[model samples]
Target: MKDKINELLERVENFRPKAVAEIEDFRVRILGRKGELTALMEEFKSVAPELKREFGQKLNELKRRAQERVAALRAEAEQAAGEASSQIADMSRPGSEEELGSRHPISLVRNQIVEVFARLGYTVADGPEIEDDWHVFSALNFPPEHPARDMQDTFFIGKNPDVLLRTHTSSIQVRTMERQQPPIRVICPGRVFRNEAISYRAHCIFHQIEGLYIDEGVSFADMKQSILYFAKEIFGEETTIRMRPSYFPFTEPSAEVDVSCNLCGGKGCNVCKGTGWLEIMGCGMVDPNVLEACGIDSKRYSGFAFGMGVERIAMLKYGVRDLRLYFENDVRFLRQFESAL
Candidate 1:
């Protein structure tokens, strides 16, 4: 029994494990239930009484040395593994190529549109998405009976009908007019909400960029030239614009602005519905009532306001038919525009 205890002590002290698994196996062989150490303990029970103390002391020493040896081997193995891993990391080497993020298509288009207007001497303006009825409807000259004022057409907040999500960025223009006087050349770019079904061509939540230019004798012709210049710059140098008579609450003489189809070069295409022109925006001379409502002298200050959906402009530029793609955040859809910036 003393010879067996001496053999185990020698084995435990000399064993050098190359891995953590080896250490676990060694521990199980020495200290686990039904192991060599357990067998030795059982054998000790049958020993003569006089020899018991000597054998028992040797067995306890053997167990203690085995446990300490295992702990030391484990520590050494872990340290060696950590050193090898640190060597492999190689901080001097260049890092792997990272997947770079990109600007959203909506943000890209909005930035482009804003930059175009910025070149035309128009500064950006902002207002709250949630607004009062006076700034959204009354200040904009929308009549009390207008369909837009109804709950079906607009998103009213809580139980109060007056507080609602703006139906258009035109509210920003109205707010701008109330604060700033004539010679106010600014563009409003922001999200607007409506209560409508989602479709390829339209959305309940969309972005609008509305421009307002108010100064003495700001003519419809001035609006025409500026829009023509913008159409050429954004669509192409060869692009042309035409206006059809239209109506709006805030504008006295409203017209729908259309640009010649750059896709078909005015020869006509399916995108234009067999017509050479594609509607892009609405523009008109600001109404006298609207001017007066905003504290601007109606007779002295005249202006033109134009509003277009940013998504609509992006659709035309990118040949994207589905409006839902803009909001979906699908990687397949977004990856295409990574190089656009």
Candidate 2:
């Protein structure tokens, strides 16, 4: 029994498990029910009383050492397994997908509009949002008594009221004509300001893209062809346009341009107010008074001018009813346009 006790004690001190499973199995063999230590405990009862004290001590020491060694070896084995797994992993593999960002819907539509006109020899023109009455109204044939000159319709900057926010990109066209001579072809795209009430269809601040073309022999026919081509290109090849006689301060024989409702296929709907048409822009032959005001010879050079609201175009193209959506900066609303190029 003494030899047995010494042998088991040496086994406990020398035991080293090659794997975590081996450590658990070793524990069961040494300390579990019906195992070596359990069997030895049963045998200890049969020993002489004087030897029982020494054997019992040795048995208890062996059991404690066995448990300690099994636990230590199991922990070491598990740590080694974890290290091996890490080393074997492929770090070069792609990680979890990261979401990509996109341009704002308004920007995307603006760029598209510019690209469309760019192909037709129209260079982009820009001007300051702030302007004097001359460039914004006077040079554009806006009479002093025009309602647009009133504070109710326009944003005045100071007590003098001459300095104000431009109500249209036509100021850019006026600036262009002042610097350049005839044969001028430019498209003005910019932000404009007004004093209108905020609503789903109207805003105090908005964007406009107005086009001007002045050269010899330019006529109303040329304007019609050009606008027709633009309507077709923007709303789809099947789109058609009609010019209803209208009025504007800067243009003679002004007409409000309407395109067949692309949404309802011209059959009439709530969007088009069941009219089977959607008002898109205004167009006319540049009023001679406007040309002379900008230093161009009204007699030698005849041209056409057209203007449209960028928000209105976007609303039609994207089917967004509320004009407020363009300005809200809501992430959820913006995320929907992520797929738009």
Candidate 3:
């Protein structure tokens, strides 16, 4: 019994495991129900009473040593595994990671809008979010008396009245017109800012996509047909549209564009406020004055301009009641869009 105890103690003190399989076998051999230490304990239990205490003590020592050896073996095995894993890991190999994102509702709508217009041969155009007055309001035909220049509507960077944050993507249209000649076909998409109280429906900042097309003899009929086609593509083939006469400072004979409410199928709903039509955009013929202001001859150049709010379109499409939700960055709300497709 003493010999066994001494043997196990030496084995435990010198214990080392080179691999996981060896550690597992060591654990079973030491701690298993039918292990050698357990058999020794059984033998000790049956020993004559005179030698019971000494033999039992030796058996317990052997059991303790065996347990310690098994623990050391396990730790050594794990250490070896870690070292080998580090050596064999392919640092140059392409990494595989989780696919954890989906397009945001706003991005989805924006891409869809771009795609629809792309099919119609309009190229995507971009400009700086921070822009100047000449391109934004001046070329777009804002009158000198227009209140938008009063510093209440625009965010100015430098003291110069020329440099300011763009309140509309109309600035991009102006830039495009100044650079590109006739047969101009471009869609400008960008961020716009306004000073407003954040509310369920309104925000101080938002996104807008504006389309401009200039060529010979572009008419209100052409504008209407283009909008109708856009409405059909966006809403559905069955969707109907109605143009409500409206006014804008830039475009002559401006009208608000609306689509038949999909939620109620034009029957009227809370979304449409019982009108059965949800206003989507505002558009009109490019004013002759605006054309002249942008260096395009009004006599030779006739075009149409249309603009829509991205968040508004997204809200109507997704039924997201609160505009604040778009900016909150709440994971719970964002995760709902995880499977956007």
* Global lDDT scores for all candidate models: 0.93, 0.91, 0.85
Whole-structure CA lDDT of model 1: 0.93
Two-way lDDT contest, 1 vs 2, winner: 1
lDDT against true structure, model 2: 0.91
| Range of the 10 consecutive residues with the lowest summed lDDT in candidate 2 | 15-24
Lowest-sum lDDT 10-residue window in model 1:
11-20
Question: What digit string (tens of lDDT, one per residue) describes model 3 on residues 117-199?
Answer: 99889999999988888887888888888998878777888789888888989999999988878899899988999867889
Question: What clash count does candidate 2 reach?
Answer: 0
lDDT of 3: 0.85
Q: Please give the lDDT score at residue 50 for candidate 1.
A: 100
| Each candidate: RMSD | 8.3, 8.1, 9.7
Which ranges in model 3 have alpha carbons more than 4 Å from their true place?
1-99
Q: Rank the candidates by lDDT, best first.
A: 1, 2, 3
Number of the top lDDT candidate: 1
Local accuracy of candidate 1 as per-residue lDDT tens digits, 15-63: 9776679999999999999789989999999999999999999999988
TM-score of each: 0.73, 0.74, 0.72
